[model samples]
Target: MPPNSQPSPPVSPDGTTDEDAVLAVRAGKGDTAAFGALYDRYVEAVYRYVYYRVHSDTDAEDLVSDVFMRALRAIPRYEPRQAFLAWLYRIARNAVIDRARRTRIQISFEDALAHPGVDQIVEPDAGLLALADKETVRAAIARLTPLQQEVIVLRFVEGYSTSEIANLVGKREGTVRGIQFRALEMLRTLIPSREALA
Candidate 1:
């Protein structure tokens, strides 16, 4: 209970200690070691999340570092109301937005789609593959609304489940599904078939 002492770990209903909550509490009280443990545990997941959004390895790595720094500074104020990862993701999401605003850098849709993960999204349609080259796909993706683009990238590129995306975006699971459905429908319309191109 001392000001500098670590708090007891939070116990779940099943009586298991929540490791993340424990680390978060200790970090909140100035325990750099606990904060480092948290950083080691989540850095990769945060990197992937940022990388897909920015579509740049260099930018993503920089943003991931920024996210952790921000999280560390804010740890004293952090409440374990949600998963620590979710809180970190909110910081990352904001960092990406802030970088975009500061640099006015338009994310390259071609680069995003060039990632191997995107093949999984477009592979179901042979016509799409045959007709839509990187430029065509890029154009189609760029035409999507920002929210639609985010949903598409998170779902297809990051492979997050609807519920997980809902948590990250602070939307309902049903809403995430609706957004994904609408985004996919828009993509179908935007990307012409091979027959249409012919």
Candidate 2:
């Protein structure tokens, strides 16, 4: 089945049952509704991850589609050994790498938001808002190495724990934490004005 294009998971006034792994297992068995549920759950996150790497709404959207397409095909092979989010993110990271290699794409993070759509994907930070432009924040992040970029985005933006990030990135937790620190240090240097964050 194609990736779920459903708007959102259903919720009654009381609550809704939407455990990701359960949905994934069901989807693995060719349950279209279950797969759609999974799609609704992860689409925004996948888009956010892709947006940071590609820095272009069009590219990010395309890559997100690709990620889901690949996911749909591979769900049958997915095991519950890890969180579905972790597995999905691994796929996304790989997709970005593959696309970059195929196209020889050179990402310019600062200029990525020149398109209107990406602005919605990356909520402007209070500090970044102070920069008086999203591009400034993008430029600051652009200066980070790819690993630094992933660490920073996952750490601060997505709020993933170091261990969780380490699992996703295939690094040790210490390494992920160190990368986060260095990425922050680089951002501090690149965006010297504290008010830029204010």
Candidate 3:
């Protein structure tokens, strides 16, 4: 790739985030229709994040709903931190972590493997539409620590930029880059052929 060339962005499946951002702004002012529009735009991605972290459909569903509710309340103060989705993602991540801690349980690799279908995930290098079976990728991600898994998911599946992820996770940009590099190295060891996902 040329130095001047930009990395390709994940194709938006539903083709609608700009509209959602506008709606989010309106929703902050108490527009139920606007909020509903925003909800419809991102519920799937939010659910995917929650479900991947918690590995339970029930928990993910609850967390996604709660995250949005909190977001709604917080939206009045939502300053549009990272891109709106990144901001929403940050909220979802925290809720997932808090939910896991509250249960006095950590999601283990075994648990994640037990039900891989919870998140619609793809291979590390594949087109977003050509997702690997959720279980296979979930099991591989489970092999890493939650922090590593989170970075990997954010970098790959969620397609956050290094700077964006750092802001989302409250880490330095350099730290986020280092972690992403390390996560890839670890993933290579856990699952051979780094380019296979593509």
Candidate 4:
């Protein structure tokens, strides 16, 4: 509390400084270093999101680069209406959709299983593991609607809350929850219980 002292930056719930907005503001003003910082912070997250959807490491790497390029071009006009990561995710989601439209490539469950990141993507949950193997779970997830798959991956694989997912996907929190609920129900049917198998 000295007269010349400045207050510390705000911290997020996870204890990290919530500097993305500040960095974004700086980047908007042509600060390349600020933008680089943001890129370092979120490139992996964007890669994971894109990789899961596309199921191709080569394509995901290309898309991540494209997403950041698009974000760099578009950040000057960025508004902080939502978390910066959420805004970035919107860009990534759109990029994936655009690629899918261009290629018209259907992502098969077999391809998802063959993806190198498959084991990392579907970490075993005790309850789910009891019901089915990792391959079964991954296949069931792939079969869900795209929105459902997105919600599931963000919630479980990426450890995002429903509120965060809503912001990322531009949906109401309740809607995200409904998507998750229905996705789970569909998964249950798709992966038969051990008792049923017996």
**Per-model TM against the reference:** 0.66, 0.71, 0.64, 0.72
Local accuracy of candidate 4 as per-residue lDDT tens digits, 91-146: 98788778878988776778656744343322223265345766666656666777
Compared with the true structure, all predictions reach lDDT values of 0.68, 0.68, 0.64, 0.72
Q: 2-24 in candidate 3: lDDT tens per residue? A: 33443332223444445556777
Q: Candidate 3 at 14: error in angstroms?
A: 10
Per residue, candidate 2 scores C-alpha lDDT tens digits across 17-110 of 3367788899999899999988887798788777767656898899999999999999999887556777888898789879878988565666
lDDT comparing candidate 2 with the true structure:
0.68
Q: Of models 1 and 3, which has the larger lDDT? A: 1
Per candidate, the number of residue pairs that clash is 0, 2, 4, 0
Off by over 4 Å in 3: 1-21, 107-133, 161-164, 167-173, 188-198
Q: How does model 1 score by TM-score?
A: 0.66
Best first by lDDT, ranked = 4, 2, 1, 3
lDDT value, residue 191 of candidate 3:
47
**The best candidate in terms of TM-score:** 4
What's the CA error at residue 136 for candidate 1, in Å? 8.9
Give the number of colliding residue pairs in candidate 4.
0
Clashing pairs in model 2?
Answer: 127-196, 127-197
lDDT of 1 by residue, 77-182 (tens): 8887656766777788788778878888664767656643343334233246346776566556555655666677666656667666776667776777788777
Candidate achieving higher TM-score, 1 or 2: 2
By lDDT, who's the top model here? 4
